[model samples]
Target: MGNRILIVDDEWNMRNLIKIYLSREAFQLNEAKDGYEAIEMADQYAFDLVVLDVMLPDIDGWEVCSTIRKTSEIPILMLTARDDVKDRVLGLNIGADDYLIKPFAPEELVARVKALLRRRKKDNREIDKLLITFNDLSIDYDSRETWVKGTRVELTPKEFDILYTVAHNPKTVFTRDILLDKIWYSEEFRDLRAVDTHVKNLREKVRKAGLSFNPVKTVWGVGYKFNRPEDQY
Candidate 1:
């Protein structure tokens, strides 16, 4: 079955708004109004994800998120009317795995949901347990270990994030800005060199593993993709 998700908000329209789009897809959906009812419904059933609104009459979303995190590791994405950077940081500090400010595109909402699920699915396994194998190379996210055939490789945290992002979506080209945005969450990310630095590091690491280092391919004026010669087959 697809994941069941809970949407908690005091406004009926807001709750139903998300539900309408989500239900059109494959997710099993449920809703609760106010923080008290939200907690009650959450306790009543197991949920794969929680979409919470910040404003509630009975209580705030931050407290509800804190309470949920105290007992469970279920992924949470918070909804807020505030677009302030401080508000976003606060939500992340409080336990929201992700956040969306008001007036976001439904397509973006769906994309964020899918990204979170993909991240969770990839992260839930032990590094030694989940090896991403293609051609002669492999990467283990759980252990932060990578290899070409049987030889080991070393990677920095940023390099690993870069590698992991492309590896998860092999053959999908990414622009420099796309890679930077995906790997880092800096609000003031004007220095574009960070992406270049990480890509250089990742390429060297793959080479050090005794492999041909042909996996991470550049797209000329575009960005790059983690692809092998056999990816076309």
Candidate 2:
């Protein structure tokens, strides 16, 4: 009836303390003493979230997160010491959905967990599954998969979002400003670069798929446009 959470820590007391604190919140909680146990439990159980400690006996949280990411996008929340900002960033870069420093309040943990799950659910709801085809490249939104003439293409979430936006409405020119508003929450000009980067990355991925065709075209100083095969100059 509640969200399932796996708390992985070498210290059993720490795990138990957190479990007691979280129990009132009605989360279906589980625990693992180390990364090895975490992985084994994860492989055997379907947990909605994982709260992973950075320091583990058999394996560290970073490796655990990376290993899990190779197979699943299930949300991961890493635990790092207060002084380890680099560790926090590393966790994020390595596929952790979020991170909390040591000695964090139980209530803050609850809030962060709730916020992450809320955002993920909102994102999932916005995804409309459609099988879009242009030339040899076809995108299936339902499975979150893309293909070029039968070859699969891997895309990050942002890259996929950018491609989906433009490809959904072919031939429409979306200015950097407009795209920034559409793809990112910030209206700042600095965020415009992110849109450009995602587009660039998307194009490169398409190129890697052995397709000579580029669906997205820059509109000089104006914006970017999704060019259908027949519409390209």
Candidate 3:
């Protein structure tokens, strides 16, 4: 069977249009007309991706995305009529993987979907290297959890991704732009300060959890790098 995809939208025509376009790719498709149905289907079935529309009868797509993120790391492609940067940023910030404005080309939708799925596939390939430890800091890739001094420290999805990316490449300086491209996976939002904000939050979280050393180090005028000193090993 092909990848399972759930399309969530209230409009019958929009749902039908998406189904027609995506069915050609051999993806097993499902439909939910509202946020409640979407959330229920998402919880009940194992879907590879979700094509979500922001305007829904209940709860809204942002809530749906956050709800799903709380449990699964499923890729979400958000559809919105409003092209406001704030709206797009809100969706991305809430855990939607990618955003597409309404009236988008069928080909563009297909391309973004394929790109997200490809990225997910590539991420899955790293499952074997599940856990990495650096002194008191530890990251569990499979569980998407981080531990400091044997105590699990809560991290937002983006926070975890940023930490993992830097930690996996110790001593490698990552400019804000590089981290945005790698973690956001979309060029739509390029606010460099977002990286700094996340890193700050991640640092505080781990620090409050009893970590002694700074896990993410800042480079003056450059970017940031993992501070895995020789003693960490």
Candidate 4:
């Protein structure tokens, strides 16, 4: 079966246009007209990607994206009439994978969708052989699971990817741009602050899980790295 994609937009013409283009590319498509329907449908189905519009009737796209980021890592491409930089940065920080302004070419949208799906597949392949353990931290790439102090830790998809990447490359500093390129390769307009936001969220979750030490550390005037306790000692 081809990749399943959900298109969420209040405009019938927009949905139809996206369906027409994506259907030609062999993607299985579904449509939702509102944010509420979008969230409900997402919970009920396993969609590979969501093409979401920012201005929804009920819940806005940013809220929907944030809500989804709490549980799933399904890629999201945000559509908006507003092309403001802050709006784009806000969407990215809230977990939208990619953003497209309205009045966009359908061809460009299709290309972005293809690139996101392709990057997702590549990321999966790269993590297939990974199983990293350091002190109380444990990550199993095959299962997409993480544990701290022998207790399971819940992480969003991006959180897990960032943690796993840094953990695997212990002691190696990764700049914000580097991490963005490595993880969100298809998003060319992402904010560097998004990296800091995810790291902060990841650390808070770990701390809330009763872990005393944070494995991810900041390198002064540089970026971040994962340092094993033994290595630091």
Q: Pairs clashing in candidate 3?
A: none
How far off is residue 96 in model 1, in Å?
0.5
- Model 4 scores a TM of 0.58
Q: Write the per-residue lDDT of candidate 3 for residues 132-164, one digit (tens) a residue.
A: 788888999779999988899999999999999
TM-scores of the candidates in the order shown: 0.54, 0.56, 0.57, 0.58
Q: Per-residue lDDT of 160-232 in model 4, one digit per residue for the tens?
A: 9889899888868999888988888685668889899999999999888876678789887889999677656
Candidate 2, 1-233: lDDT as tens digits:
99899999999888998898878889999999999889888888988889899999988999999988888788998888766677778889999998888889989988888887787777665653377888897888778788888998999977887777788878688998887777676654456677888889999999988876888889899988887877766
Worst ten in a row by lDDT for model 2: 122-131
lDDT (Cα) of model 2? 0.85
| TM match of model 3 to true structure | 0.57
- Order of quality (TM-score): 4, 3, 2, 1
Better of 1 and 4 by TM-score: 4
Ranking by lDDT: 3, 4, 2, 1
Better of 2 and 3 by lDDT: 3
Highest lDDT: give the candidate number: 3
| Candidate 2 residue pairs in backbone clash | none
Query: 47-84 in candidate 1: lDDT tens per residue?
Result: 88899999989889998998888888788999999888
Q: What is the lDDT of residue 107 in candidate 2?
A: 93
lDDT of predicted model 1: 0.82
